[model samples]
Target: MITKEKILENISKIRVNKKITQKSIAEFLEIEQGSYSLLERGERDLTIDRLLQIAIFFKMDIVDIITYPNKGSYNKENEEDIKAILQIELKKDKKDQVMKLIFGDNSLEILNN
Candidate 1:
């Protein structure tokens, strides 16, 4: 069973691996730094949307995030496979929509480059 503590531990590991700070994540999520600290410490409850946002920000699948063991490492191959699958599954229009949602008006530039 997945526990909040496990998720928090995974998030902290991922963040550290990515060389990101809690303050950066908090700013991205538009939440207070103290609130974000509580989240990392497993003292605060996370909403589904917030969880999704964090997963997206980290370029990870929600399932992977939830199931990842605290001491385990990230699977780069799996992440690449997921990206390829997304590229294949998302139709041009749908991809555009998703890119717009993720990158706003810079989606085209980001996709093109």
Candidate 2:
């Protein structure tokens, strides 16, 4: 039920956030760069095994890379969206600046040490 577009978007986001090139992911996945490109473009499908490796690479839950089959993918309500993000940011302890940017307060239980 996951959409190829969403998978591509998420992969792009993760790679860019890490400042990694397709070559890097290809290397990380131990695949040819061209194959990785095809995968990114949805010309190829990601197997569960490869997806598990990606999950470990990103240190994320498998469900993250796999887009939910639910319809209306994006959150329409601002409050619900913000709350969900705050919870994740808090749990991940991503960064003080990012947490502040999202929640406007750095007093979260998960502090940047």
Residue-wise C-alpha lDDT for candidate 2, range 1-113, written one tens digit per residue: 56767877787777787787999889999999999999888788877787788778877666765653332344445555464332343444556667678668644755645
lDDT of each: 0.83, 0.72
TM-score of each: 0.58, 0.53
Q: Any idea how many clashes model 2 has?
A: 0
Instruction: Give the C-alpha lDDT of model 2.
Output: 0.72
Best by TM-score: 1
* Per-candidate alpha-carbon RMSD to the true structure: 12.6, 14.2
Candidate 1 least-lDDT 10 residues: 80-89
- Model 1, residue 54: distance off in Å is 0.4
Angstrom error of the Cα, residue 99, model 2: value is 46
Off by over 4 Å in 2: 67-113
TM-score of 1: 0.58
